[model samples]
Target: MRFIIQRDHLVQSVQDVMKAVTSRTTIPILTGIKMVVSDEGVTLTGSDSDVSIESFIPKEEDDKEIVDIKQTGAIVLQAKFFSEMVKKLPSDTVEIEVQNHLQTVIRSGNSEFNLIGLDADEYPHLPQVEEENIFKIPTDLLKAMIRQTSFAVSTSETRPILTGVNWKIENNELNCIATDSHRLALRKAKVEIDSAAHYNVVIPGKSLNELSKILADNNELIDIVITENQILFKAKHLLFFSRLLEGNYPDTSRLIPTESKTDVVLQTKEFLQAIDRASLLAREGRNNVVKLSTLEDKIVEISSNTPEVGKVVEEIKALSVEGEELKISFSAKYMMDALKALEGTEIKVSFTGAMRPFIIQPINDDSILQLILPVRTY
Candidate 1:
């Protein structure tokens, strides 16, 4: 295989695919990235069984040439060394060639290096997903959904399903939910589809996080296809595939409280900053717990005390406080996370009781919601 590609283009494509390549893999060939050069363009694929990413660099885009292929062939090269070489190449273009014995040579400007290559045939084939069940969503909105929920996924691997985010689609709406038994983050958005379909899939939070980072903030639409065990995300010239977890996600609909004893509306930033300062002391405690109580005339007190450390007490006036007055203790870290995920300036926090789970959501938006389980501080 032989190809001549621009330095910047190759570097970007390599970085995108590198997210899927793992340094430690049971299969030896999984550590290498497969490169295929055809008449149309050059394709680079990286996979580690659980996730796969492919990037295509067309010969000409917008009537400009991006790659000049000298021969049509394929080869696999060590991902780490090849990526580093492309990034450090001191030239506008890079030339790659592979010999009969799988020896790969890369040259750019005055630098040239030889790397041991593996046969592309030994690499595992990516899952083939049919486009029959496909939908489209804006890249930025998808990234937002991932960011809002992926952080809440359980880090413990005892129950593998909890380590993934649940994705459900029904009636043209895409819902993403993640929980670690202590808290939950949910986000919903409208999608473009031809026919209605209901899907329940659990995707690894780590994979979604990587996908979010790779997605550009442009207005381009991404095509999503779901199969029985795999999900595919396609952008302009990139394809991302992930294997679905093989277990039923726990039903979380009943976990949200239906009633509220106390409700307070406050600026998101104000509450976040208050909790940030209060947590400084709470973090030193065993549970990182902070107490919030409603006072007369709509004043909310944020306080935390540690016997070995100092105490912090602050009062922030709420936009409006309704229902009965209540005091609750919860993890300051959880509260800060929920606050940061909120998009609106004003947020409404609803509490059913001192010990029940409370919800934090935007004042007027019903699409996004966050729930945190209050910590018991006796």
Candidate 2:
């Protein structure tokens, strides 16, 4: 393949695809980025088995030539070296050409480098997902949903299913839930769909994170296609495909408590900061547990103690406190994560009891909920 392309566009495309490229991939070709030059444009593809990303750059856009293709062909170049070389190229235009014996040459300004390229035919093909079940969501809302729930996915691989976020669509509403047995995050949104399509799938949290990072924060629509074992996200000129995690995700609906023993309303910022400060001491001890105790006159005492380290206690006046008195201990990190995800001026925390899981949600918004299992402090 031979093409002279704009340097800036080339760099952006390479960077976007690089998120899927990994040196640890067992397949040698998977570690490289595949570049295909055609009459329409230049397409760059990168895959690491679990996730695949393809970016296309048109030959000419808006009457300006972005790529001048001399020959229509394809080559797989080592992503590690190629990405670095493209970034350091001294000119605004980049020239790439391939010759016999899989030899590739890249030239820009006064610098030129020769790289050994692999036959693109050996690379594993991206999953061919037919347009069967498809849905669309706003880019900004999708990103927000990912941010609110992906963080709650388990980082451990022991329970592979828990490492992904569970997605369920019914009644034109999409519900996403993630939990690591200790803390859980759930977000629901209404979607536009023609058929009454109901789907329950678990998508890798890592894949969602990378996809969200690439998506722009706008109201533009993103097409989502779901197959048996793969899910495809189409955004403008990019196509992202991720393998779905096998096995049924545990039913988490039963985990949410129905009755509450105590319900307290507090300022989100104040509560988050108190937990942040209290966690400093908890971090020196065990699982970063912070304690919250309800006091008279609507005061909530947040404290943490470690025998070896100093203790911290802060009193924050609640907007209102009702029901039974409560004292609960939970992971400060988890609590802070939920609070940050639910960004609002006021929040209502409902405690089932001192031992049972408690929920933290915005006062006015019921679409998002965060639950944290209390830790026992003897």
Candidate 3:
């Protein structure tokens, strides 16, 4: 295999694929990057069994030659060394050639390095998801959904299913929900689909986070395909595949309370800042719990106390406080996370009781909702 390619393009492709490459992979070949040069373009692939990413660089784009291929072939090179070498290459162009016995030479402006290559055939194949159950969503919206929900996935693998975000699609509306048994985040978006496909899948939170970082922020629609065990995200010049977790995600619909005992509307920023300040001392406590007590005339007192640290109390006037007055305690970090995920100036927090899980959502926008379980401080 031999190719002379634009260095920047190669570097970007390498970085994108490297998100899937890991030194900890059990398969020896999975640690290296597989590169294939064809008549159309050069393709780079990386995988760790759980996630696989492939990036393509066209030979010529818009009448400009981006890669000049001398011989169409394939090779796999050590991803760690190859990625670092490509970035530090002195020239704008890089030439790669392979000789007998899988010996590879990489050359740039005054520097040349020899690397041992592996046969590309040994690399595992990424799943070929059928296009039958495909949907399209705007890239920017997809990223927002990921950011809003992925953070709530359980970090503990005790209940392995909760470590992923549950995606349920019906009637062209996609609902994403994640929870760690303490806090839950839900985001809904409408997508275009090819069929009346009803898909309930659990996607690993790590995979979605990685995909969010790699995808460009754009309004263009990206194709998504879901099968029984794998999901594919197809973007321009990129293919991302993630294996679905092999278990039924717990039914979380019943977890959201239907009735409210106390409902308070407050400025999102003010509430968030109060929690941030109150958390300063709450962090020293065992549970990092901050207390919220409803006061007269649409005001709420935010306070926290730690015997060793100190106590903090602040009053924030809400837009309106309805229903019954109540006091509740919850994790300060969880409230801050929910507030950051919302996009609005005002928010409505509905509390069923002092001990029940409360719901926080942006006022007038029902597409996103966050729920936090209260902590007990008796």
Candidate 4:
């Protein structure tokens, strides 16, 4: 196998595929990257059994050559060393040639290195997912959706399903929900797809986060295909595959409160800043709890006190505080995370009671919703 490729493109492609490679895999060959040189282009693949990524660099695009293929063949090289070597190669182009006995030589700008390559045939084949049930979403919206909800996934493995974000698409509406049991984030968006499209899947939060890091923030649509056990995301010159979680995601709809006992409208920024300041003292507390109480004339007080540390108290004026007066204690970190995820100037915080879960949502927009269970401080 021999190919001369542009250095910049090679570096970028290597970085993207490296996200899927891991050193702790049971299959030894999975530690290396599989490279296939063909007549059409060069394909690089990396996988850790759970997640796999593939990048294809065409021989030429728009009459400009990207890869000059000398011989059609395949090789597997150690991912860690090969990636670092390609990044630091001192040349505009790098030439890679596989010699007898699986010996691979890399050369660029008077720098030459030989690496013992593994046979590409030893690499496990990626799952073959049919593209019949396909859905499309814009890259930027997908990234935003991941950012807004992935954080809420449970880190604990006791209930494995909660470690992933539940994705449900039906009637052209996409709804994503993630929760660690203490807090929940829900994001909704309209997808342009065939009316008959329907799917319910659980995608690992870690995989989504890694995918988000590699996706370009653009209006380009990403084609998604779902099967019985795997989900494939196809982008320009890239293909990402992730194994679906095995269990059915818990029903989260019943968890959201339908009615509010008290509702307060406040500027999102001011509330976030007040919570941030109050958390300084709360951080020293075991639960990191901050208290919020409604006062007369639409004033809300934010306070936190730790015995070892001084207390913090601040008051912020709300646009309107209606219904019964409320006092709720919750983790400051949870509140701040929810506030940052919400998109808008003004937000409505609804409380069912001092002991029940409360919701924070952007005023007049139902696309995003956040729920935090109040911490018991009694």
In order of appearance, the predictions have TM-scores of: 0.98, 0.98, 0.98, 0.98
* Per-residue lDDT value at 274 in model 3: 97
Candidate 2: stretches off by over 4 Å:
none
Q: Estimate the Cα RMSD of every predicted model relative to the unseen true structure.
A: 0.9, 1.0, 1.0, 1.0
What does candidate 2 score on TM? 0.98
Off by over 4 Å in 1: none
Write candidate 4's Cα lDDT for 68-157 as tens digits.
999989999999999999999999999999999599999999999999999998889999998887788999999999999999999999
How accurate locally, in lDDT, is each candidate?
Answer: 0.93, 0.94, 0.95, 0.94
Q: Write the per-residue lDDT of candidate 1 for residues 148-220, one digit (tens) a residue.
A: 8999999999989999999999888899999999999999999997656989999999999989989999879
What is the C-alpha lDDT profile of model 2 across 1-378, one tens digit per residue? Answer: 788999999999999999999999889899899998999999999999999999999999999999999998999999999999999999999999998948999999999999999999888889999997789999999999999999999999999999999999998899999999999999999987756798999999999999998888899999999888999999988999999999999999999998898999999999999999999988988689999999999999999888887899999999999999888899999999999999689999999988899999999898999999998876
Ten residues in a row with the worst lDDT in model 4? 280-289
Candidate 1 C-alpha error for residue 171, in Å: 1.3
